[model samples]
Target: AEEARQTTQFEPLPKSLFQPLPPFEDLPRPLSPSGASALIDEAKQAVIDTGSPVLDTEAEPGFAVMRGLALHKLLQMLPGIAEAERRDAAARYLKRAGAQWPETERDKALASVATILADSHFDQLFASNSRAEVAVMGRLEVKGKLRSISGKIDRLAVTSGKVSIVDYKTNRPAPATLADVPPAYVLQLALYRALLQPLYPEHEVSAALLFTEAPRLIELPPAVMDNALARLTGA
Candidate 1:
């Protein structure tokens, strides 16, 4: 009856039950902006130490990282302050950060913030009912493959019964279309959507990328996301 049906629904797959689980090491956890940058540098150094064929590490802590961090701080303060106050705060932070930036790069970093603030898309997204630096975690089962997924969403917008996941990027020349988005970014958004959809079954879930450099939002299409999931789990 109801009990037997429930048991069948929750039964583990035979292959999964027999398969060896992954090692109990520290999972690949998301890090803060600065921490992520440092980790990249460390990883590059490790590759260099091993004398592996790795790309040059000449762009560590590049302008994109600096601009993204400054913009993140501005967005965090925007919700709590008036338009004028928000502008003042952004200016102050950029000035402080630029003081430490190299003379050749200081002006470019500060200018990027002004450009972002001026973008209509940037203003609209932040003005929405959103939470910053939100953490998401869930177990995803795709095509019989089960895996644990966790990451910190840059922004989560909840309006009425619709949910939007927003991730910030600092690509110099922002992607012009959904197809232009990096594969890793597309997969990340797909994973976020999967993790969130079940929790808000009644709400429609969607995701987009906000490229800080170009200051625009690119909505991810459902079909593209499905493909990403298929590739992710080799379904």
Candidate 2:
């Protein structure tokens, strides 16, 4: 029996690892525009699987994410360059940024950006009146408590005493209408509008989602934004 017996020892995990998790309110985490929208959706039990990372700068982003980044970078730099030279500049930047991308992928990004530049309807977006990567930070009341939120607007345009907040979306098969738009996206723009509105109080503040893949722009109506704000702050 002694010869056949096998001795085994068990190791306990660290006590810290075994400790019960704290209440939701006790664990503090920074909220980004996407995270805030996710939280709002979770509260309403309307969450969907968008599969979007919290930040574009995440380590080891997938091919699609990398493509999106390349497109955003191109958009940011293109506005500063004269329209005639944007294509060449875009080609050079994409060649460097997407060195490993398939030739087709590189060509697609170039074409999409080219479409955006050629669309006269978007003239204001690339005009001198607009700015890219506008940083916004402020405290807003949420669920009867003040919470600090910060986000960078992809594009901010001031024209005719009106402010337009533009966020670029690389999602394919873009929403055909406001109703088809994701609630998280709407929430994101609402938060941006709330933060920027005070800074340009005298001007009418508007927001839109620019789907780069389709080169389509969808402006968010005031009523839609108001509804989203109500859901966000529990007003």
Candidate 3:
């Protein structure tokens, strides 16, 4: 007769090095003085060297979000899967799933940030926010370039003869004075304005920030916008 069937059930494995870290870092160091653009350029070079496709248009946000979430998931289970496999599965699994992942923390953070938009509510709000409201959530595209760099515009409104360029801030609002606001925020909008300048030759390129987070308007004048463009172009 067949031996009595033996029964076994899976149990949680003993704790190992497979745990995850806190989602967000607690006040980690800031980006270097040179800023992120230099690092971006370096990455672009590496991609070119590896024959990666140049970004001609923005991909669907979901594609980005899923890729991000998968990475986070992989990081957590990598050790366990890795120990049973290569013992260095983080690098290999990342490659097998998708090669050429970004090495910098900023790019990873950006990927994670895209996850926020994956929320259907946020997506709906974003879509509704873009509708005729014209306060940002629109005007993001290659903006008429062969190989386009992505840009998130602040806002678009028809004011008399002018079409306003606007940006929103979830952080502390910048001061009305150019000197008072953070240089990066000013530059951020300035870059968008510059890229958009050729398209809107008629309207003056203006940059303003809505301090939704600060619950105030820290408006930067058009002159400040000009200064920002000047600095960007090294003019």
Candidate 4:
């Protein structure tokens, strides 16, 4: 019995069989517009990590964050309401949603919403043909990797001549020039343009950032969008 046992040669299992499986790259990567923006520009993530004042300077960020969200909600719902009723409706909505907020903050948000609704520059955006909270989904090639991105456009306007994508911003002092705009914002708008162009091939697709704080609309130029796309795809 001892000789039989000694003669039995036992081979070890292959290490490859025990190795961890490679990352699953085939699955679609779910990324929001903001997330894709940050992924494309590492600096954006760095700025977030550092809490750059350009983003926020709140002693208590929770209030600021919630305030922004409340404003966004108002913007989303305001377009559906009659323009004449928007001001009173906005006041009521904010009063309910912002009961815990300081009176000043609530009033400020109400004023901002009123200003955005009344801005003649954004008249086309709130037109009958426009849609708010538009869901967009598409696959984009990012530096040799394919990724799926999905996000909701704050507002999308479809006209006979053009398809407009508008993203609202609440920055206290919005970017004054194209050069001053954040890289992430540019990337976000550019990606939206790419995703929506195929849907409206006959019409020109345009994107812009509407700063609600001061009610300014800054349209991104074709050259700027093209450059951002080139950088994102590593072309």
Q: Across residues 68-122, which tens digit of lDDT does each residue of candidate 4 receive?
A: 7787788888888887888889888888888998898788889878887887877
Q: lDDT, candidate 2, residue 107?
A: 96
Question: What TM-score goes with each of the models?
Answer: 0.68, 0.81, 0.37, 0.81
Runs in model 1 deviating more than 4 A are 1-63, 102-124, 142-145
CA deviation > 4 Å runs, candidate 4: 1-28, 41-55
For candidate 3, list the clashing residue pairs, or say none: 136-155, 154-166, 154-167, 155-166
Model 3 alpha-carbon drift over 4 Å, by segment: 1-148, 172-178
Instruction: Give the candidate number with the greatest lDDT.
Output: 2
Residue 131 in model 1: lDDT? 81
* lDDT per residue (tens digit) for residues 1-235 in model 3: 2333322344556676577765983543332211313322222351112111111124344444444444344423432232335234444555555444455523443333244333353332233223222222223222131222345453454444454555544332224454655666665565566566676678765556543322234556767766654543435
Model 1, residue 229: C-alpha shift (Å): 1.1
> Clashing residue pairs, candidate 2?
none
Clashing pairs in 4: none
lDDT at residue 166 of model 3 (Cα atoms)? 52
